[model samples]
Target: MKRFVGFVKKEFYHIFRDRRSLFILFGMPIVQVMLFGFAITNEINNVDIAILDHSKDASTKEIIEKISASKYFSVKDYLDNENEIETAFKKGKIKAVLNFEKDFSKKLQTENQATIQILTDATDPNTANTISNYTGAILQNYQELINKDIVTPYQINTQTQLFYNKELKSVFMFVPGVMTIILMLVSAMMTSISITREKELGTMEILLVSPLKPLQVIIGKVVPYIFLSVINAIIIILLSIFIFKMPIAGNYFLLAAETILFIINALSLGILISTVSASQQTAMMISLMGLMLPVILLSGFIFPITSMPLPLQVISNIIPAKWFIIILKGIMLKGVGLAYLWKETLILIGMTLFFIAISVKKYKTRLE
Candidate 1:
C-alpha cells in the first residue's frame, strides 16, 4: 500500500512540478468551453448586405433602414443596377443582395403587396441559410408593423418544422467535440508525455527493478491519468448539463462505459507512442502532430466526415475519435441505447484491445 501510494505521489510530483503544463491542463476545458460557447457559432450578426432599391421611396428606404438598424445586418453598398449585384457578390463586397421592385410603394398601395428579391451567396451553406432566415424575419416584422392597423381579409400562418433538434442549439454539437478534445488531450497526449518523461530521466529502469511487477508499474503510472480523464469527462458532462442545458438522453451507465472504453484506447495508444519515442519532446510531437491533429480534423470534430473526400472519409474510419463522437451524439442527443450503438462500442473495444496488446508486446520486447 505504501509503495503504491509512493508511486502515485512521485507521478503527481512529476506532473505538478511543471507549473506551465499544469496551468494548461486545467485551462484546456475552460478554453474549450469559452471557444465553443462564445466564438464558434452559427448565429449571424453584423453581416454586410448590399441593397438595390429601384423604388427609391420613403417606404422602401424605411425597410432598408429597419434591416440595417437591426443587429444582424449592415447595408454597405447601394447598388445601381442588376449587373452590380453579381460584381458585388463576386468581389466579396456583400453576403446578400436585397433588390426592391421598381414600383414597391405603388404596388403596396394598389394591390396591398409588393415584391423584393433576396439573393445570398450560397458558397457556405449554413451561413447563407442563416442570412436568408434573418432577412425573411426582418421583412416579416416590417410587414406586420406597417399592416398592424390594416387587417387583411385572409390570414397566412407559418408552420416551422425542426427535425431531430427542435431548438437547433449549437451546444449539442460543441459539447461532444469538446469532450473528445479534452479526452484526447488528457488521456493520449499527457500519458505519452509522462511515460516518455520517465524514460528521458532514466527513472523507468529504477521502477522496473523495484518490487512492483511490470504490469503493476504500468498500472501505477496509468491509474492517475485514468482518474483524471474520467474526471474531465464528468466535468464536461456537468458543464453541458448545468450550464449549456444539453440533455443526456441515453442511459448514464452506458455513457460512462463508452467513455471508459475510449479512455483506455487513448491511454493504450499513448503507451504505444511512449515505447517508440526516445524523449518527452518526441512523444509530445507525436501526440500533437500525429494524434491531436487527426482527432481535430479527420474525426469530424470541426467538419463532417461525410463531406470529406472519398480517401479521407476512408481514412477517418480508422480514427478513434470519429466513432466515439458518433457514440456521443447518438447517446447524448438522440437518446440511443446500446442496441443502436453496438457497432461503435465494438469498434472502440477492438481498438482498445489492439492498442493494449501492441503496447504490451513492445514493452516486453524492449525488456527482453
Candidate 2:
C-alpha cells in the first residue's frame, strides 16, 4: 500500500513538474467547454434578411413589420428588382430574401391568398432551414392576426416536447461529448505516449531486467493514469453540473461504473498503442492524429453521424468514443439505466478486450 502510494505520488510529481501536460490535463477541458458553449451554437439569431417588396402595399408592409419585429431576423436591405436580390446575396451580408408579389394586397383580397417567395442561401443547410421556419412562423402569425374574426372549421396545433433538454441548449448536447473526448485524450493519448517514452529513453530495459514482471511494470504505469483520469473526469462533471447546470438524471453509481468501463477501454487502447509505437513521438502523433480526429469528427461530437457520408458513417461505427458518447448521453441525458445502454457498454467491453489481447500478443512477441 505504501509502495502504491509512493508510485502515485511520483506520477503526480511528474505531471505537475511538466507545465505542458498540466495545461493540457486541466486547461483543455475549460477551454473546450467555453469554446463549444459560446462558439458552436445551433440557435439562429439576428440573421440578416433582404426584403424585395414589389407590391408597395399595406399587406406587404404589415408582413415586413412582423418579420422585423421578431428576434430571428433583421432587415438588412430593400431590393427594388430581381437583379438586386442576387447582388445582395453575393455580398454575403444577407442569409435570406423575402419577396412579396407585385399586387400582394389586391391579390390577397380578391383571391384570399397571395404568394410570397422566401429565398434562402442553403450553403449552411441547418441555418437555412431554421431561417425558413422562422419566416414561415412569422407569416402564420400575420395570417392568424388578419383572420382573428374568422373561425376555422378544423385547427391543428403541435406541442413539441423536447425531452432531456427542455430549453434545447446546445451545451447540454456538447457537455457529454466533450467529456468523453477529454477523458479519452488524457487516458489514452497521454498514457500511450508516456509508456512509449520509457521505451525510447531505454528505461524500459532497466525495469524489465529488474525484479518486476512485465504485467506489474505495465500496471504501475497505467494505474496512476486511471487515478488521474478519474480525478479529471470528476472535475469535468462538477464543472458541467455547477457551471453549465447540466443535469445528471441517472444513478451516480451507474454513471461511475460506465465511466470506469470507458476509462479501462481507453487505457487498454493506450497499451496497444504503446506496444506498436517505436517512440513517444510516434505514439503521441498516432494518438492525436488517428484517435483524436475520429473522436471529434466521426463520434457525433460536432457532427451528427446520421448526416455523414455513408462511408464515414460506417467507419464511425468502430470508434470507441462514438459508443462511449452514446452511452454517456443515454445515461446522463435520457436518465437510462444499464438495460438501455447495455449494447454500447458491451461493445466498449469487447473493444477493451480486443485491445488488451493485441497488446498482450505484441508484448509476448517483444519478450520472445
Candidate 3:
C-alpha cells in the first residue's frame, strides 16, 4: 500500500513537473469547450439576401419589409434585374436572391397565388437550405398575417416543441460531445503515449522483469490517467453547468458512473495501443489521427448521423466514442437511465473487452 501510494505520488510529480503536459491536461478541455461552444455552430443567422421586385407594389413592398424585419435574413442589396442578382451572388455579397414576379399583388388578388422565385447559391448547401427555409417561413408568416382578417373554413394550427434544447442551442449539444472527446483524448491518447514512453526509455522491460505482474504494471500506468481524466471530466461538467448554464437532468451518480465506464474503455484502448506501438511518437500519432478525427467527425458530435453518407454512417458504428457520446446525450439531455442507454453501455463494454483481450494477447506474445 505504501509502494502504491509512492507510485501515485511519483505520477503526480511527473504530471506537475511537466508544464506542457499539465497545460494540455487541464487547459485543453476548457479551450475545446469554448471553441466548440462559441466558434462552431450549425444554426443559421443573419443570412444576407438580395431582392429583385419587378412589381414594386404594396404586397411586394410588404413582403420585402417582412423579410428585412426577420432576424434570420438581412437584405443586403436591392437588385435591379436577374443579371444584377447573378452579379451580386458572384461578388459574394448575397447568399440568396428573392425575385417577385411581375404584377405580384394583382396576380395574388385575382389568382389567389403569386410566383416568387428564390434563387440561392448552392455552393454551400447548408447555408442555401437555411436561407431558403427562412425565406419560405417569412412568406408564410406574411400570408397568414394578411389572411388573418378573413377566417377560413378550415385552419390547421401547428405548434412545435423542441425538446431537450428548447432554443436549439448548438452549445447544449456540443458540451457533452466536447466532454466525450476531451476525456477520450486525455485518457486514451495521453495514456498510450505515456506508457509507450516507458517502453521507449527501457523502463517497461525492467518493471516487467520485476516481481510486479503485467496487470499491476498496466494498472499502475493507467491509474494516473484515470485520475487526471476524472478531474478533467469534473472541470468540464462544472464549467458547462455553472458557466454555460447547461442542465444536468439525470442522476449525478449515474452520470459519473457512465463517465468512469467511458474513461475505462478509453484507458483500455490506450493500453492496447501502447502494447502495439514501438514508440511514444507512434502511439501519439496513432491516437490523434486514428482515434481523434473519427471521434470528432463521425461521432455525431458536430454533424448529425442522419446527414452523413451511408458508408460513413456504417463506419461510425465501430467508433466507441460515438456510443459514449450517445450515452452521454441520453443521460445528460434526455435524462434517461440504464434502461434507455443499455445498448450503448453494452457496446462500450464489448469494445473495452475487445481492446483488453487484444492487448493481453499482444503483450503475452511479446514476452514469448
| lDDT per model vs. reference | 0.75, 0.75, 0.75
Judge candidate 3 against the unseen true structure and give its global Cα lDDT, from 0 to 1: 0.75
lDDT of 2 at 184: 89
Give the clash count for each candidate. 0, 0, 0
User: Could you give candidate 2's per-residue lDDT for residues 165-251 as a string of tens digits?
Assistant: 545577776888899999888889867886688787888777666786666666776788888888988999999999998888778
Return the TM-score for each candidate structure: 0.57, 0.59, 0.60
Evaluate residue 39 in candidate 2 and report its C-alpha lDDT on the 0 to 100 scale.
36
Indicate whether candidate 1 or candidate 2 has the larger TM-score.
2
Q: Residues 162-266, candidate 3: write the lDDT tens digits.
A: 235555566676788889899898788877886688888888777667786666767777788888889989999999999998888777998999998899899
What local lDDT does model 3 show for residue 176? 82
Residues 243-310 of candidate 1 have per-residue lDDT tens digits of: 99888877899999999889888887888788778898878877886777668777866654433445
lDDT of 1: 0.75
Residue pairs with clashing backbones, model 3? none
